[model samples]
Target: MTKRIVILGGGTGGTLAANRLRRALDAEYEITVVDRDDDHVYQPGLLFVPFGLAQADDLVRSRHRQLHDGIAYLGSGVDRVDTEADRVHLADGGVLDYDVLIIATGARLVPEETDGLTGPGWMTKAFSFYDLEGATALARTLEEFDGGRLVVNVVDMPIKCPVAPLEFCFLADWYFQERGIRDQVRLTYVTPLDGAFTKPVASRTLSGMLQDKGIELVTEFNTGEVDGEAGKLISFDGREVEFDLAVVVPAHGGAECIERSWGLGDALGFVPTDEHTLQSKARDNIFVIGDAAAIPTSKAGSVTHFEGEVLTRNVARFLAGEELDASFDGHTNCFIESGFGKALLIDFNYDTEPLPGHYPSAVGLPLLAESRLNHLGKLMFAWLYWHSLLPGRDLPGVSTAMPRAGKRFETR
Candidate 1:
């Protein structure tokens, strides 16, 4: 009997994992990918939409077209997973039996979790660039406004592409400068964290940039409520930030199906897995990847790309009844877009923080430093994401492991 592999979610991790697994396994293994829809969104493009750099149509493609010919694609919502019986239940009452299962159903933004966020003035005084609709709506809103107190608030942490909120503020500053209303617009960055970013060095560097850009940074703000009608963000500590226009990155949680499936995930619906091996702690036959896994790392596409390399190999080892490679070191790389057509690149892992050096080589793009070259590289990533990354083609010289050769470490 041929072994069956069922993958949930056809986004970056699922798409790449399906394609790579198809190439690695023989023709006997049956591989199938399930997603709620056919739309494969380039999520990073959402950041550019509000600034008029990218459009909603330009960032999306058919999910079916991205997968290999032999791989089966199912367009249906997941109901739950029966790990004991090794079966996946679809929302449409279809059941799929699999020898192996992969969970790649990435994080879901829960705006409803925040009080008064989706209430009155939503899509008008308040918006989020995380979703396509929110981005496009914000574009129109930004065009009509000449000046106001524009605030960008991140409701909670573990949000996708953690640096995107900062990038928005940076771009907003440039956008207003170009519009000749730089003095009129008062920009503020509100976050739940104590700094501009998660890591200390990166936080200091980013906070300085915010100061230079005249964007006020409000830290340790645990948002309790969004009084949209009053245009205020109330914190749990009785503090409040008033805003004329608010762009909020809402609280994010895992997919509903994960919650529906008993013993599959945490309260937030994120799967608990061995951080390095990507194997679900709940079951050995199951694997988790991308934002779906509760890993202490940045939930970015680059992280997904790096995870795919390790995940595919681990899946192969599991099928072969061999020892799994626990080499994934929380490797994450992010291009932080600053104003004036410049960007900064940071590469790090669990053991190392992002330091000043070159990436991939001793003389590559400057690390932890803003440059036009990095901005161009950031733009070039969209092309790479669609063409090479999703197709499971290895990016030359970029390994799953963070290379220390070109990185400069500071001795504390």
Candidate 2:
């Protein structure tokens, strides 16, 4: 009898893991991927959509078509995981029994968690670019805005693409400049973090950029409510920031199914897993990857790609009754758009911070430095995502571990 492997969520992590596992395992294993729908969105493209750089149609594709032919694809929402019974219950009254399970359901934006965020002026005065509809609605909002206090607030931390709020600010500056109303717009970036970003060095660099663009930085702001009718963002500390137009990144949480699955997740619905091994702490036969795992890392697509490499290997080892490799180092790399056809690339792992140098090779694209070449690389990623990343094809010269060969470390 062939062993069964069930993967939840047919997004980036699930699709890549399914394809990679199919290629690695022999005919003795059956791979199945479950998702709620057929739409596989290129999430990074959402940033470009509001700026008219990319379209909604260009960002989505058939999730079922991305998987390998031998892999089974189920278009249904998951109800819960019966870990003790070694089975999964689906919303459509179906049950899938598996010898091994992989959870890659990813994070969800809960706008309703914030008071008045989705009420009154939603899609009119306030908006979010985290989803396709929100991005499209915001595009129209930005187009007609003449000027005034344009505030971008991050409701909480651990949101998907931590750098995206900063990217929006940068692009907004460029957009206003292009329209010859740069001076009319007063841009303010409000975040709960004490700095512009999570990392210190990068935060300082980004903070300086914000100042250069004449954008105000409001840090240590814990949002209490978004009075959309009044166009004010109130923080828990009694501080308030008023806005004529507000772009908010709502609080993110794990899928509801994870919480419904008893003893399968943390308080936030994120699965607790061995950070390095990617195996669930709740059960030995279960694995967690991407944003679904409660790991101290950026919940970005690049992180998912790195996790897939280690996760697929570990899953194969587990099925063969071998010791799993605890080798994942929270490796992540992202291209930060700084607008005006320029961008910055940052590569870092568990112990290393992003440094100024070249990446992959001594002569490769400059790291932690803005350049037009990096912007081009950012655009090229959309092509790579569908053709290489999702297909589980190895990107040339890129490895699972963060490379130190070309990085320049700063002396403390």
Candidate 3:
């Protein structure tokens, strides 16, 4: 008798989970992955795409190729999950039965939620780097503009790569300087959050960086509408931020299929899972990982990477009839690119804000401090992502748990 493991959404989490589980599980357990297509975009690269540092072709690769040899890949859109029957329904009228189900469907951008955002100026003056098409179009737009009000706005929170917006601002500063128009472009950052970031220490650090770069920061502006013809982002309280060019990080939600499945997800279609255990609240035999999990964390690749490691062991333990491990500590880390060839690193878990100090200790890569070496590390990550990260090879020093050293632990 063989066990069936069906993983949905072959993005970062799904792909990595399939590969690692295939290596760990025997021939008696069959692993199958379901996704819409084979196009896997190196999502972080999209930030650079608009600035010409990356290309559409460079960022996308065949998703099926990233999986292990034995893992079965189904490149079709999912329709719904018959959790009661222990099966998944496909959009094209196919079905998949599983002894264990893993939801790694991640998230999708909802641009239409904002009035007039996806209207006339979309992809022309208003754009996003959250996806491949938006990044490609914004790249062309940025290359042609000499100088204007370039406003980067976050429509809401719980979005992917939370630091990416700040990185864009930093890179914009560098981009304009290189083009000899640094003084001409007026850069503004608008977010629904009260500060530059969710983490207190990182927010103070990043907010100061915005000030240093002459990027105006507007906080707590809940967007009401985008008056594209008038070139303004109007907040619900009638506050308006005018912009000649807008790079909007729109609201994000989990896959629609997750929503269609009753009691499987939250209002945003994200799976309500045990934050530590990664077990779906709706079913005992189902687990959720990555962005799809409705966890109070940034939906970033690093988080997905960490979740995969912990989830793999738990899945195996479940099959072996053991107690579930509650070791996943909402662990996540990100590199903050702060332009001028400098970057900062931050590491923390659910209960900790990004602190200043060396990671893994008080003396490794300086955290919350801008360094050129960290910038090099940031650039080198694209290579590491393709060759090391997706392959599930454990880096010697980078542990899944957030480190406590090298942080300025003072109160905000």
Candidate 4:
């Protein structure tokens, strides 16, 4: 008798898991992946798409090709997951029975959540760079604008790549400088957080950069409505920030299919996952990973990559009837692009905020510090993302556990 391992998504987590397990597990276990489309996007590249740094074709490939041999790839939307019966229902009325399941359905952007967000000014005066289409449209809008109040607003938290909005503002500074209109462009970063970033130190550092670049930092401004017709962003407290162009990071929610599954997700549709083990609250055999998991960490690709390793091992442990390992420490690292061919890297976990240090080894890439080398590393990551990350090849030095090497602690 063979065991069936079904994965619900073919994005970062699902694709990597399928390929990794295909290599580690024997031929006896049948592995099947279900996703809506065959397009595998390098999501980070979407950020560069608006700036003409990356083309659409360069960021996407066939999902089937990324998977390992003997792994079945099904291109169909998941209708529902029957946890009790250990079965996955497809949108096409087919059913897949599995001994183990990996739910990586990821997340969806909800621009419509904000009143007047998807209105007449959408894709005209207001745009987003979170999606490829939105990024492309924003590129055009950014190019056409000569000088005005350019405001970047994040409608809510838990967005994919929380640092990306800062990156966009940083790049916009450079973009305008190149066009000889830097002084004319007024850049503003509006976020619900009290600072530039989620962490205090990094927030201070990023806030400094915003100040240096002449980008106004508006903290704790909860966006309630986008008055696209009026060219103003209305906050919940009745404060309105007028803008000629708005780059809106809309509210994000879990996949709608999660709702159809019944009691599988939270009110926002995010799967209720165990923080340490990534196990679904709904069932013992089902595990959730990546953006779908309601974790305290940023919904970034690096988080998913780190989670995949721990999750794969846990899935194996679950199948072999072994004790679950609570080794996943919510470790997440991100390369903050600060323009001018310089970038900053940050490493931390759930208990730890991002600290300044060298990562992997005591001498390697400096964390929480801007360096041209880090910028090169950020560029190099696209290759690593496609070849190493999606294929599930563990890099030699990068580990799931966050290292304290080269870190300086304050004495009480």
TM-score for each prediction?
0.99, 0.99, 0.98, 0.98
lDDT of 3: 0.91
Across 1-412, the per-residue lDDT of candidate 1 in tens digits comes to: 7999999999999999999999999988999999999999999989999988888899999999999878999999999999999999999999999999999999999999998999998988999999989999999999888998999999998899999999999999999999999999999999999999988888888999999989999999999899999999999889999999999999999999999999999989999999999999999999998999999899999999999988999999999999999988999999999979999999999889888889987979989899999999999999999899999988987898988988888721
- Badly placed stretches (over 4 Å) of model 3 are 410-412
TM-score of 2: 0.99
lDDT of 4: 0.90
For model 1, the stretches where C-alpha displacement exceeds 4 angstroms are none
Segments in model 2 whose C-alpha atoms lie over 4 Å from true places: none
Q: Residues 1-412, candidate 2: write the lDDT tens digits.
A: 8999999999999999999999999988999999999999999999988888899998999999999889999999999999999999999999999999999999999999998999998999999999999999999889999989999999998899899999999999999999999999999999999999988878888999999999999999999899999999999889999999999999999999999999999988899999999999999999998899999888989999999988999999999899999999999899999999999998888888877789987889998889999999999999999999999988998998989888888621
Comparing 2 and 3 on lDDT, the stronger one: 2
Ten contiguous residues with the weakest lDDT in model 2 = 403-412
lDDT of 3 by residue, 1-412 (tens): 9999999999889988888898889989999999998899899889889988888898888999999788999989999999999999999999999999999999989999999999998888899999999999999999999988999999988799999998999999999999999999999999999999998888999999999989999999999899888999999999999999999999999999999998898999999999998999999899998999998888989999988888999999999999999989988888998878899998888999888878778777878889998888888888888787888777678888876666667744
Q: Would you list the C-alpha lDDT of every candidate in the order shown?
A: 0.94, 0.94, 0.91, 0.90
Residue clash pairs of candidate 2: none
Task: Give the per-residue lDDT digits (tens) of candidate 4, residues 1-412.
Answer: 8999999999999999898888878899999999999888888888787777788788889988998889999999899988778888899999999999999999899999999999989999999999888998888877789999999999998899999999999989988998999999899999999999988878888999999999999999999999998999999999999999999999999998898888799989999999899988888899988999998888989999999888988888898999888888898989989888999998888988887778866799988888998999999999999889999998778888878776654410
Query: How many times do residue backbones clash in model 2?
Result: 0
